[model samples]
Each structure stands twice: as C-alpha cells, then as structure tokens.
Target: MSARLRPLIAALALAAVASLTLGAAPAATAAPAPKPAGDDFPHPDLRLTYDATVRYRSEQAAIADGYQRTDECVEDPQLGGMGYHYVKPAHIGSTDPTRPAAILYEEDHKTGKRELVAVEWVVPNTGQSWPVLFGQPFDGPFDFEPVGPHYSLHAWIFKKNPSGVFSPYNPRVHCGPCPEGHAHP
Candidate 1:
C-alpha cells in the first residue's frame, strides 16, 4: 500500500532506513529466517503458524492459502527492491508483526499473477527489535508508519528490498492503476 510522501528523496530515505541493518546483510545463502519447528511461532507478534513453503513459495499456493490481490502495491528497486502488498481477505484481522496474515509479491508483468517476494506483519501497535521480532538480525528496517492507519513491519525475506529489508515501501515497485502525481511509497 502506498501513501503520501515527503517528496521522493526524503520518502526514499525513510523507507531505506527502516529496512537497513547496522551492517550489510549476510549472503542470501545464509538462510537467516528459518521456519519454526513443530508448532512454534516465529515471533512474539505473530499470531498464527506457517509452513516452510511460506518463506519463498509460489504465488498460486499463496492465493490458495487465502491471500488476495490488491491495488496496494509498492516498488522500491533502488537498493534491491521490496515488492508489493498482495493483501489477504478483509476477514483476516490485524495481526502481529511477527507473522503476517497477508503476503508481499513482485509483479510478473508478462504473466500478470506476480511472484511471491516477501512477507510482513502489520500490527495496530508498534516496535520490537529486528533480531527478536523475526528471529534474525534485521531483515529490513522496521517501519512504524505505513500507508494505512496501522503500524506495519515489512520483512523482505524472500527478496531484498532496496529500501531496506524491512522498509514498508519499495521505491521501484509500482502499480498500473495508481494515478500519476498522487505520490505513492
């Protein structure tokens, strides 16, 4: 979901800071955010459990699992690129930032359905350290503010968000329907 910005440069800075770690993230092969074992929840904020496939799975599976496509897509390819919010049904209540009820995906323009890119937790409330929140040392910068009224945290687990691992908006991410000059990200 995109929102009004404080001009492009400043907005990009905020998104970047939110996703950045104190140091460069380790190589992708490191596998920092491993799925929980048995029934354990990954973070304190998360309210539900998920399978390993949820980490970097296909879009078809995510839709089958209940996520829905939305116009609230973000793009921040500047750093690397966080994708867009492919939100879940309205029935999915606001849950913890530890485990996202919804998912994030990158648009596959050629195919149209997009690809699973990342996941997040949009809580009605805010702030938990990066390490404690997602069982990793800052996947992305933590974002207290997002497009909607809620406090959201983005975790670019599957793909690296250029804004930062946790930056809510991806600078390079875009939506075809978003009217021009309206300012999103």
Candidate 2:
C-alpha cells in the first residue's frame, strides 16, 4: 500500500477500535458508594485503633470526652449483648454522611463495664436510605434490631463482629446484667 494511504487507513482504524471498545462497556447500574467526607465535615476517624492515644476507652470515658449516651442502656439478651448509644457533639443534622460520630459500647457480660466495641456513623435520613449500608432499599432509615430505624453503619473497631465488620450488630457481642427475666444461654 502507499505510505500516504497507510497513515490515513491506520488513523481510521484506530478511531473505529476506540469507538467499539467504548461502546461495548456495560452500562453502570449504580454509582460507587461514597467514602467518609474528607475534611469537608470533620469527625474522629473511628477506624483508628482504640487505645490511650485515641479519645474514649469506655462508655464513661466516651462521656467524659464529651460523647453523650443517646438512650437508656439496654441489655440485648439474644446476642448476649449490651448496646450503649452515644453521639458525638457535632454529629447532628446532616453534616458528613460518613462521619464516625456515634459510639456503641459493647459491655462485657462478665465485667458489666462498657468497652468500645464499635464506632457508628449515622446519616439520620430515613428507612429508605438502607441500600448502601444494609444492601436493600426501604421506606426509612436502616434499623438495627432492638434499636429500630436509624440511618447508620457500624465498624467494630475495638472488637470483632461475627456477622460483619460493617454490620449493624455483632452476633458475638454480649450485654451483661440483662434486664429482669431476660437472661438466657
């Protein structure tokens, strides 16, 4: 073939290949789930190891460090778990969607003292906001059983979750000093 014809033909061939490659890609069904707001809305990076250097160690320490108990502590006998809900100071109405701002104490069954088991990120949207976290869509916020209906995700930072790391509850966690008549194996 002629050199001039060869260059023209190659250019055309490259353009066609590019178009075909681009067009063959499958249409995206969903966008990637968002990450923690990077400095946009600030909160403690709960993914960090919980220790002396980190803020709170126990529920009391969490409160001493300005975290507040969100509800009266409850004994979750089914999982042998106790969950103490505490929210950070600035984790209020619609700030960072991925802020690690809520603290859940997984009180030891034998000790009866609160230990930092997980760090919770709350969105406070509605049950409809379950897809990204709970893997299903609904009408209101994602609900962790025994604590119903709140847009949140939990990372077991100090402890391990038999269910999952990002799961709402840990199947192996224990809530000691359970309520009256509620204790069982």
Q: How far in Å is the alpha carbon of 28 misplaced in model 2?
A: 54
CA RMSD, predictions in order: 21.8, 16.7
Per-candidate TM-score against the hidden true structure: 0.46, 0.50
Top lDDT prediction, candidate number: 2
- Reference-based TM-score, model 1: 0.46
* Candidate 1 per-residue C-alpha lDDT over 95-160 given as tens digits, one digit per residue, 9 for 90 to 100: 435336567777766468676656765433234433334554333333334333344556555544
lDDT of 2 by residue, 102-144 (tens): 7777666666667666666555554342434333222236556
Candidate 2 regions off by >4 Å? 1-53, 74-82, 93-99, 126-150, 177-185
**lDDT (0 to 1) per candidate:** 0.52, 0.55
Candidate 1 local distance difference test against the native? 0.52
